[model samples]
Target: MTVLVSAAIDEDVEFERVWLDDASWVDVARGWLVGPDAVHSALLDRARWRQNKLWRYDHWVEEPRMGAPARHGFGEPLHPVIPKLHRALEHRFGVALSGPGVALYRDGNDGVAFHRDRDLRWLDDTLIAIVSLGQRRPWHLRPGANRFAHDLQNKGATHDISPASGDLLVMGGRCQVGWEHSVPHVRHPIGPRISLQWRWTSRRGHPVRGPSYRAPRNFSR
Candidate 1:
């Protein structure tokens, strides 16, 4: 099957870099996707979304949001714009970014807690790029000492960035290792939001883990 790219991206989009401690940084580009509304609606109608239940606190609980894995094994076609966006990122960043994982925030209550991307966190250096569609939501980042802290909300100061529809946010350097990020739950009513994420690892030969809330081996307090 031949995949076609979309013309929804702003070819001249410029990124504003935000540097953090320990060689971590984030790049932000507002209004990057020229057709965010159309893309979001298409995914809502075409993508295979599921409510994942995870093992949290010794019990299985439904995850706050709905997700469609990178490989939707049920013959589902990925958004055509996904490949176009990935290629754009790889060209600009000069790295092989892979897997445009999809996540849907149905409402204000749907969110993810502060946690590192398990596969990328332990690596020496990495990059995780995300594009936001639909409604706007705050993405919080803060330095963390714990490998898997269930609750780190009030521990220290946080840098918050609310990426509106069509915005782009890329976390790079040691951001995964030295910092944690989350889209906290909100109270007021809101429409659905979609996040398209892609990641790259400098040390592909090194072992990496999948998404988990539990602490990994060699984790220190």
Candidate 2:
């Protein structure tokens, strides 16, 4: 039997923060996870994956990418690295976070459209941390239409940050409300990429509603 191990985070790991308008910012940390190839392989081989269907045009259509089996409730078993990463994030960001919501983008064909996270209880002042594994892919971000209408009209620059294997990217400070993001499809062939995400919000106890990117079972009418 092979024992799975997750390397401890390096204390000296540095992150570059790019501030967007409306107090939104993105933090990128290159080469954060150690031996990401092994991690990606482990997830691909061991974890159960599912295809989610979305209610599109006239009927339900299968989602572009595959998702991990939903683990509802607490104390469920997770990857060895999940808890360690969660603790590190909470300690570093000074906020309590919940999750290891896993997403797998298999090849360039699998991508998500730009959208703000509406499922959270509070969109503003929230933070989401993601650790990327496997091939490099562009994570595109642009100003929200509600806040930066002029920028969009003027063809404002879209920020494209590619998180390679073992990289970490975080978005915070009104990002969900002030900006939109997506993983756009590409023509070139690319390997699978797995993202383990953790999220935090200071405004708690508010009723959580809206279409969640993770909840594909829900329909949009």
Best by TM-score: 2
lDDT of 2 by residue, 1-221 (tens): 33555555656878999998758999998887777777777677766789988765457788898888424236444456667778888988998988778889999999987778777768768999999888888888887653345446223337888898888899999888768888888789988889888888778445457556655453346
Q: In candidate 1, what are the lDDT values of residues 1-221, reduced to their tens digit? A: 32333437898888899998858999999999887887787778767799887655456788899998654346554666677888899999999988788999999999987777875635558899999999997888878764345466543437888999999999998787778888988899999999999999887435555545643223335
Off by over 4 Å in 2: 1-6, 70-78, 146-157, 204-221
Evaluate residue 79 in candidate 1 and report its C-alpha lDDT on the 0 to 100 scale. 61
Candidate 1 ranges with C-alpha deviation above 4 Å: 1-7, 70-77, 145-157, 204-211, 214-221
TM-score of every prediction relative to native? 0.83, 0.83
The stretch of ten residues in a row with the least summed lDDT in candidate 1 is 211-220
Q: Which residue pairs collide in model 1, if any?
A: none
> Which residue pairs in model 2 clash with each other?
none
